[model samples]
Target chain A: MEGGVYLNLPKVAVLTMEGTNNEEEAFQSWRGAGANAEIIHIKKLENKIRKLEEFDAIFFPGGFSAGDYVRAGAIMASRLRATVMRDIENFVDAGKLIMGSCNGFQVLIELGLIPNIGGDYEREAALATNLSNRFEARTVYLKITNNTCPFLRKFRINQIIRLPIAHFEGRFIPANEDLLEEISNNNMIGLKYVDPYGKEVGYPWNPNGSVLNIAGVCSKSGNVLGLMPHPERVFNKYTQSDWPRGNEEDYGQLFFKGAVDYLNEKF
Target chain B: MKINIIVTLKDNVEDAEGQSVLKALHLLGYDEVSNVRTGKVYYIEMKGNDLSKGYEFCDKLLANPVINKCKVERDD
Candidate 1:
């Protein structure tokens, strides 16, 4: 369907930077979900060529930004914090939407967007190196833990979905035990790694050995979401690994669509 | 002055890289090696001799306080 067919379609900015790939698919996913999408370089925002305020939602695609120097997503997060932090804070305050996957998820954690327990954007969690000690590249099962998040409204609680995850540092580690409790109590965890049958069998099923089998998390407000899996890559059922095995679910498209629907109704 | 910052995962956190290195060392007949921890060192040159600046840099960028501990040292 043409975006022109929909009035006031949400404008999405797929934010990218050097070494940050996957913007192409992310843009396509947003457009497929009936949103106007554009791939914007970080430099554009830094140089004032384009402003975050112009977009209704922002998508941070996957890949190693700044070559993953210092840490995955650390460089990009620091640069954004140094330059457009105020704009981001304003965007969040305005109740807009934000989503990130894989390295993008790492950026959100580094920026302290998800699980911003202090409400000050102070870093409170880290996506540490995988306990497997190697880069895990495979499609895994995820159980939707919180359907209240805009990105997950199309899903149901305890619904199992399949998405591809590729990364070396995908483990979700909170700053402390109290923070972990807060994330759980607030229903900030959006997804959890699970088996094909929705069992929490550790290892290859969990992939990263993330705490509490967390595969994705959301901000306390449920507007911002970050996950280690690449939903954009699997927007089509044919792209899923088990599609040849008679899988017919296009699980990824719902993520973008849900957010777009929310943006249109709310913003 | 040159400031050096060493960033490593906190002691309580599981160090997968360190464990891998320890396993490799044990295989190479270095059984006496009890432990191995991994970290990154950044050497920065500054005109001003301010160790606090280095700490500030670490806090803002070089180190993520959630999983990392940064030690800043000044070399003149």
Candidate 2:
């Protein structure tokens, strides 16, 4: 490692499991943001081979985890809940960071980490199948709803950015109207799907038809973030689909860099 | 002992898969069908004949209360 600030870089774990194919991208993105990152399999945590306490941040990348058997992230979430539930709670209690994108976002909802209004990790939302009844794979414009989240601190509130989203079940449905209201009342929403003009729209614009056009959600404390877009997949300007048309923003790296910066300052 | 569990999506949630099937059925001239919803069934074999274990499985992993409701049946 280099001298100076690199001497105490934040450690990030890119958690993965069977069918989760994006760990490599997640690991590289974190490393690109000046963090010590490792791709750790979920089995390592389940078997007690790796400890969550060893890492400053955990990232669940996008993929069809556990084959998306019963649901997009049901099996993986259940497995994690069975083994590392308490450890995850302790990790959150310590004000550490956790970010999940795409299927990883579904896993966080399944694990009751995002929009955890009850504060007991109760499953309060489900990302059902898209209203189009088809798998959506495309670049989407997302308006940053809240920037207080550790993962979104680098972005300005209400700023619209483009990110790629690919998933079958990406619709965000809270348990009830009251819970949905509570999520908004608590400022847990992080991003909303928007048109190129930054207007909240439906169908092609909101890819999944998520209620309220919610594209991402954060926990009450803003340490945990779950979103359906794959920011890790587009760590550089060239990877973005429209970059060839004179676009030059490396938005993906900012999400990781923001979390790394937060970890460095707080821990 | 054998236990059977049927898990179904709650009424409030949109059943996209079921809706797709319904659309296909309508295209096939099955307009008589008004609604369609899909679900899953799981069969488990347990050494002990306690029905509570089946419910426990549903609570733990078989079904998520946020979107699904499960029914457990056991044969003793």
Candidate 3:
């Protein structure tokens, strides 16, 4: 039946665990974009009830997964690395489009999946506590630095979009300048914190004092994207903090939509 | 044996927590203190005297070599 094509949408797993409260919105965003998405507990993957290869893509939603006590995204990444590191590594290597938001971004960095300079899971960076020394929750303007990344294809290069970021450890600093140079040279820097006017700014404008004002990044392959922003919360304009200010377009949904669209077109 | 591990950001990395603490100390009239840095301490209890295992944990899980360094002290 030709109508069966609609029933064969790509499956996206919005992985979750106790304290990870953002899976619902992430799942909705994926499903809203025509993917069959689900809120899957990390245990399901760990216990092998569900398999990573079953899904076309996997998303790590924002939340204090594992209470974020030791470090943001530390425990969850450690657990996953211990159990399913090979599967996840292969998933990224296979270009299955993995994405993470906010705390999930921290997990990616902890897992050494982003800016994976040498194709090895060597953690070359750390998302330390914000320079302001507090959890910041605000809408920030991000300049899309690289459109070649599948996640940022909907956005034009240098396009500035508004997204809300909420986190304490949002500062993205790599281990050394060499690695930073490598990421920049590879165009792995996907999003940069900028003012609404699109000027690279500092403090309140930058929001997290990230090095070079980086807000999001992709791997060298650009299939995996990690950003410290709550794109899921703004699936619609009404969810945006500035909705009353004549906000109309939903920029956040475009990201997930782009990923889904890429998956559909590719596989 | 009990092993105590102290983990802290490398000296070059900016310690925002330490700066905030310094600010508080200045407000408290203790102006002589020149520097402050925040770090973590973890105590691991084990039965073997294999010192290399402690360093191994430090290299792998206990400390992020990218931005942190860890020191292990043995307490028998």
Name the best candidate (by lDDT): 1
Extract clashing residue pairs from model 3.
Answer: none
Q: How displaced is residue A157 in candidate 3, in Å?
A: 1.5
Compute the lDDT of residue A225 as modeled in candidate 3. 95
Tell me the lDDT of model 1 at B71: 95
Rank the candidate models, highest lDDT first: 1, 2, 3
Q: Rank the candidates by TM-score, best first.
A: 1, 3, 2
- Model 2: what is its DockQ? 0.75
**iRMS (Å) per candidate:** 0.5, 1.1, 1.2
Q: Write candidate 3's Cα lDDT for A1-267 as tens digits.
A: 244875699889899988887899998898888888988998999999999999999999998998996678888988898899999988987889899999999899989998789778988899998999989998888999999888789988898888888899989999899999999999899999988788999999888889999999999988999999888999887899868886457988989889989999988
Tell me the lDDT of candidate 1: 0.93
> RMSD of each candidate?
1.3, 1.6, 1.8
Q: Which stretches of candidate 1 lie over 4 Å from their true place?
A: A1-7
lDDT of 3 by residue, B48-74 (tens): 898778878776666767788888899
lDDT (10s digit) by residue, model 2, range B14-33: 89899999999999999999
Better of 1 and 3 by DockQ: 1
Give RMSD (Å) of candidate 3 vs. truth. 1.8
lDDT of 1 by residue, A1-267 (tens): 554665568899999999998999999999999898999999999999999999999999999999999999999999999999999999999999999999999999999898899999999999999999999999898999999999999998999999999999999999999999999999999999999899888999999889999999999999999999999998998988879886457899999999999998997
